[model samples]
Target: MQTTSTYKILVVDDDPDIVEMLHYNLTREGYHVAQAGNGKTAIEEAQAFKPDIILLDVMMPVLDGIAACRQLRDISEFRHTHIIFLTARSEEFSEVAAFEAGADDFLTKPIKPRALLSRLAAFKRRDAQQDEISNVIEIAGLRIDRTSFAVYKGDSKITLPKKEFELLSFLAATPNKVFSREELLHNIWGSDVYVIARTVDVHIRKVREKIGEENIRTIKGVGYKFNTD
Candidate 1:
């Protein structure tokens, strides 16, 4: 139901030029925009701006993007917020670290404005689709609540990053039905977003860590299933 005009975006980068470019482009697209010069400031700005989407830079003074992302994810209010990392580092480890820190997406700069815009549009479509799905699923002792974007294992609360939570929720929704990694990638990340199949495995592992490994069963070479038995 939220329109482009109402959707807030926070662009955080140490480089003034990058921040300026992103601000101009996002504002031109009718998105309400805010900017921060570093990760530390980004967190403070996020508290006040309350952006639906955040474009964060990796290398920064005061605090790094990965640390900032981890800190942000710990905050209950921002748990479901979209965080995309924009970094010059294209190394595989950097990408893995970014995801581990709870980033929703990773982009290497020099940023292509058009591609970034397309990704943002894809996120908007995904959000709309998410709104149409069932909001909660309870299985065994686990409860996945999409309404608050929170999960509960019996009376104990478990906090999972956005992608991990989605992966768990999607599988748990279908009980014992097994879903391939490709199917999970398409369903959770969407077909428009380019991410390797391994990303699913990473998220699956993280989800298991929070909710317990026994809840999700890996079917040899086939894929993963939520164990209802």
Candidate 2:
């Protein structure tokens, strides 16, 4: 459903040179590209352009990338838009923070143009494959819609950011089946990602906060399972 020609991307950074370089590379790859010099302008451009992906710089003026990412995550319209934090910082804490703020991926600065192209291509392929799969899963008292990226509890809709929703949906897809943390990290975060295995706990806690803790049961020294029984 997503063609390279129609795929839109927004590159947000404080440096005009970086923005221009990114714009050039992305456009050359057949993507419609937009540029924003700050997080605030990035938000405005995102709202207006409705880009499918956003390459966000971590350090910026007016508003920082982490804050902007959190803000965007709160809005349902940007729920499924892929966000990758592009930063010079390679610290583990920085990566964890980005994920907590709702980034889909993190890329270190000075990224090779070829690497960026490969990553974007992979995402596009995954998205296309996802479209062919069932987007709605209904069980217990919840309805998870992958297409609209929404979750409904009975008649009320409960808003969850991207990662939380994906984790919940993955668990609910196989009710009562326990999944280990390593398995979760591999499946949800992708095996190539460098997130700590313990990061799963943070996301799990957030999911429990939104939904009832009773729904997701944790096994000591094991993993977690969706209790539909």
Candidate 3:
């Protein structure tokens, strides 16, 4: 199928080769590209570039992607930006860790450009649909009532599923902090059942989409935490 490139993507990592490789492939595909070699720079570039999507690395110096995701989440201007983690680690906990960091999705190393593009395509569709959803969490807009099985973005009502609301409430209970998938599993889903941590990622993506609010920050290699500030 023929497609037009309308998305601006930000690629952040400490590895120059990865940056170069992605930049070349993405640009060749007709999407605009931006790069940063470290976490702080990733935040800076994201702010300046105003990309439609971000491909963030898990490990970096002077503010790993997880921390920067926390900060980027605070800025209202970049609220709608979609974030996906680009990591070299692919263990049971690895994916869960990225989700805890607020990542929308994850991709392992030995870069597969085709797979990357396809994933971005799905993200684009999901991202477009997210614009109309209202995921307003609140504490009078300060406290997201992940409790009461509800979310109020300063008095506005944002509906969510039972599971989604539970997860949000748990994460929001502690804003701007990280939570590993294991912790979330035990807390949100309970530890007694058998499940993959990636289930958290599925729920997180759903939560973000439904809220229509973009404040959850993904910390690449870690887990997720809510950010209200």
Best by TM-score: 1
Across 1-229, the per-residue lDDT of candidate 2 in tens digits comes to 7899999999999988888888999998899999898899999999999999999999889998999999998787997788988888554446668878888887787867887887787678767866776769998888998776688888898888766887898898999999999988877767555577667888898899988888899988999988887
Quote the positional error of residue 33 for candidate 3 in Å.
0.6
lDDT of 3 by residue, 3-111 (tens): 4376799999888989999999999989999999888988888878998788888778888877787677667565446677776755343555555555556677877
TM per candidate = 0.93, 0.91, 0.59
| Per-candidate local distance difference test | 0.88, 0.85, 0.71
Candidate order by decreasing TM-score: 1, 2, 3
RMSD of each: 1.7, 2.0, 10.6
Off-target runs (Cα >4 Å) in candidate 1 are: 89-93
- Overall local distance difference test of candidate 3: 0.71
The candidate 2 region of ten consecutive residues with least summed lDDT is: 89-98
Q: Candidate 2: global Cα-lDDT?
A: 0.85
Q: In model 1, what is the error at residue 209, expressed in angstroms?
A: 1.7
Best by lDDT: 1
Error of 2 at 222 (Å): 2.6
